[model samples]
Target: MAKWGMVIDLDKCTGCTACTTSCGMENNRLPGENWQDVLFYQEGEFPSGTLKWFPRPCMHCENASCVEVCPTRATYKDADGFVLIDWNKCIGCKYCMIACPYGVRFYTDEKAPIQPDVKQVFKGDGQRSWNPPWRAPDSRDDWKHGVGIQPNGVVSKCTFCYHRVSKAPKGTPDLNPANPALREFTPACVVTCAPTARYFGDLSNPNSEVSKMIANQRGVRLRDHTGNKPQVYYLTGGAGGAVPTDRRGKKA
Candidate 1:
């Protein structure tokens, strides 16, 4: 029942893309498609200008505009309050993409990886053709949940690695059973972060580390004025640093 969330400290982020690569591999995403990305934004005058790197991922907003606009209902809020995509049901209309404030959704123009055809020699089983059973017409239903493939012809985005998090062991009574406490229930990007700038936990629990960090730090959500109520929070600098600004010198 805990509201899962993430906090990223810009101070500790070094712009290394370990997190991005890890997320792609962990989710078996198609090449050039990233579940998370680090973006560089330049601001200020020529003499005093500065470049800042911002890591962007699914905000998992409480009022998710993406979910509201999906005609197929492929995108919906999961029981744990994280926005998820049911790729099988997605029609690839990309309505969700247009509605998303964070630009997290992606559509694949090409087919995902198919099982490679294996060549068999004449001596092997009396000239028998070798092919993975899973790829066989009848076996498709059996291996539906296996890795390295997602349902084709649909939209995709960060699920917070819900499949992996759901499989982690339930540790203690104090923690949510779905995501254990002893083991860090991080999405792939969080685990691969070189600087360990990302932190994930139950934001609903007032005593949780993420909750305390949010309370203690000067955290800000992107485009909060839109009333998206995003769960992701960012800590850009120490208490007195200048507020983050966009390319046009407007507050971000």
Candidate 2:
């Protein structure tokens, strides 16, 4: 009965974009299709102003707007508190995309390469995310919990790396403080954060790091007026920064 969530310490983030890169490779995202992004904005006067960066991901709201407007129920919240998209059920209507206040969703449109570079992102679990188009006659269908590069015309966004979090040890935090693994038991964005600006844990657990961060740092969610209740929390320190509304993974 764990509700998974993340905390992005804005004070610690350096806008290095390791999270975005890892997410792209792990999820096999295209050039313009960014599931994780660092939203940048400038505030105040030019010379006296400041440049700030906010690493943006899916909010995974308690009452997600995307889920509410999905005509086909393709976008839904899982029992574990993660909002997800069922690719098979998605009808390419773009309703969920419109409903998302963060503007994080992207309509996939033939972004896959003709012959995917092995050096690029994975297409299956063993090799890549899903079998290439050429594998149609004998597609690899056994990759359980699979989410290959989304087909054309479907809107897709971050899933909080649901595939990894689901396998975490029960009752225990996903990323072990004593022995954290960069390539296991965490979302690609969280694990690859070089500065360790991100933290993910079970929010329902009072003792979890995420819960403690929110309590200790007064972590705030984005766009409070929307009443979306984003699970992702931010702790702003130093100068703090403004997040760009169109944070669509503009090449990090």
Q: Tell me the TM-score of each prediction against the true structure.
A: 0.75, 0.81
Q: How high is the lDDT of residue 29 in model 1?
A: 53
Q: Highest lDDT: give the candidate number.
A: 2
Off by over 4 Å in 2: 110-146, 177-183, 240-252
Model 2's alpha-carbon lDDT is 0.75
Instruction: Name the Cα RMSD for model 2.
Output: 6.0
**Could you say which candidate leads in TM-score?**
2
lDDT measured at residue 233 in model 2 versus the true structure, 0 to 100: 91
Off by over 4 Å in 1: 110-148, 169-184, 238-245, 249-252
Per-residue lDDT of 26-65 in model 2, one digit per residue for the tens? 7776655678988777655658867777789989999899
The clash tally of candidate 2 reads: 7
lDDT of 1 by residue, 1-252 (tens): 757788888888888878888886666554456678777666667898777667888899999999899897878887676788776577779898899988887775443333331222111132112223333243222111222334445677777767555444442112222344534445777777777788877778788777888899967888887788898888777422223554465476
